[model samples]
Target: TPTAVASTIKAKNYIKTITYDNSQEDFVEKWLDQVFSEALQIRSDNKFTDEVPQRYEVPIIGFDCLKSATTLIFMNLKSNKYEIIDRPGPRSCPIHIIVKSTENSIHLKFIDAKNYVSADMELDDFLRDIGKVEPCESLIKESWLLLSAIDNRIKDYTDYHIDLLQNASLAKLSCLKKYAYCYKNFNISSCYNPEDKANPFDLSMRYWKSKVNSYNEQDKRKKRRIDHNITYDDYQHFHDVFLTQRCHMCQARFTYNNKPTLDRIVNEKSHTKINVLPCCPYCNNLPMTISNQEVYDSLRNDMRNIKISDCAIRKPYLRIASQLNQKRRDVNAQHHYKWLTLQQIIQNMDYIHVTDDDTDSLCLAIAH
Candidate 1:
């Protein structure tokens, strides 16, 4: 089905010219020239000069009458055509102008003039335009709910720093599992089992210390128990070991297929700190967090089951009087059914298996 088209109207004839009184004439001119220059520069770069003519003019006025005329010009042009010239106007004597494109030129005018007439008309037009736009009810509702949940989580973490730490650890573990594919060629068992270790890159101790200190300060403010020992280096170590080890979520020692996999948390000190959960290429182009793993797993399992069922029934079959059925027909039917059942059983078994490795394996891998 086609999606609903958004409501839109070209504000081509709403605002034309803006005139500033003598008091604001200088500032208005400066603002007008700057905005016009910027627009022209952008247009020139994009080769939009033909669509938007190059003959732009900045008109300056000193008297009230010129200001009134500028106001009138602004009132006639479209809202979209009129580029906001200056900062938002002040109450007593505001300073700001807007540019309105004209037939072969552009007109500059003040934002406020004698009558509240221009402002009110523009506002009315804006409101009417807004009414024309299509509303995505479902998207809006979903976004609001998601935002509310995030806000609540943030507040909870703020009140309890330990809550953030707990969430971070879980998130880091999930991240490691996602990128386990990268260790297919390597001895994953060694990586998963910290005792059977290999030397990997060192964790960023400085980065981890900063994160721990930040958390500590927050904990003090909240009067909560602080775990200052936990550092970014520790998280990095955990991530490095996970990737070096061939530790699938299932704890199976299968070789990886050389696909590009990302560690969940990127421990860059400049942009991010401690552990940053990376995105999953398979899941809606979104980064997978620890909290979202359960939801993702459930959905993935359901989809897999549905696909398996669909595949098994790809061909239509009818039960016949079996006592004298052809030997070939009986064998073929039995073979097909058995194969399907076996596939389903394997899938179910795979889904139930989970590795019991601790975070220490990941930490040790990176430490090496």
Candidate 2:
């Protein structure tokens, strides 16, 4: 009965993405026309299905941006609940749009409902700054809605990290649990020795403290009060106790030469527990200026032919990323701090090569 109820609920909540070609002139007008056509189709489809559970909901819209300006419209369901009307005349709901702008054109990227409202505000600010707000008044009003309607379940940083740890691998999960247990009574300071080079955790903590101090110094120079209130215990609880076996950015397993280090996800932010994550030394050495989106784009471009469910980096992609990272540094050195663009990285892919011969050696070089 539970399975049957789930099936019925799924059937009633199922909604498809309606796409349109925005390449032609008067694309906005054509998009509106196609939206109307989809509504008509929904009404017609409902006529054949007498079951309310089988009725269609409002479909999302995706625009082809390869040849034209990309504008993707997604459904903003209130409280993550799809409105399944018993007596619906073509189901309708609010829409969320993403507009990614380049030098000459704009494209759309897939974003969830939570980001929809922020995207709207960003779009509004952009339009207003460029003095084009009046022209897009109707467009903005139709698509944008107050984010207060959506329920935000993320209460604090602990909740966020707890969710992140839920997505950890089994190996990582086991290590985390074990480390957390061991660290409860473990005296980290007792493990530190001035003469011991083998003590990585101690050395890593020293380095982390130095970096945090440097960040605070920079804030002092900027006349901002040093807000980096992170303690050694916080580091122990969040970072050192995690027993990270893989790089959070590239998912590369840690080796003897590639040990874990805390990398700041956002450099401008403090080295608080929430801002840092375990990253391999190799990945940590990569260009610090690279945005999270740029890294994803680079990886996606390199692994276009590979089948990956969550964009997890393979050995070959990892090598490619390393090469691109080197390229970024070289360009920065030659061009005076200019970050390499995604297109440049993609263009250099033909020159980048990786081999699987070191698999045995890599597996052997696993960190303790």
Error of 1 at 255 (Å): 22
List the RMSD of every prediction in angstroms.
28.1, 22.1
Which has the greatest lDDT? Answer: 2
Q: How large an RMSD does model 1 have?
A: 28.1
| Worst ten in a row by lDDT for model 2 | 1-10
Clash number by candidate, in order: 25, 0
Off by over 4 Å in 1: 1-200, 203-205, 214-225, 228-368
As a TM-score, model 1 comes out at: 0.16
Tell me the tens digit of each residue's lDDT in model 2 across 1-368. 00000000011335333323334544444444444444455445434332222222233221111112122122221222112222212123222333322221222222233222233344334334322333244422323221111112112213212221121122333333333343344332231111312323433566556656765676567565456545554545544443444466555544444456667766666555677677766555554443455454445443321234332331212221221233333333213112222112222221122212222211101011
lDDT, candidate 1, equals 0.32
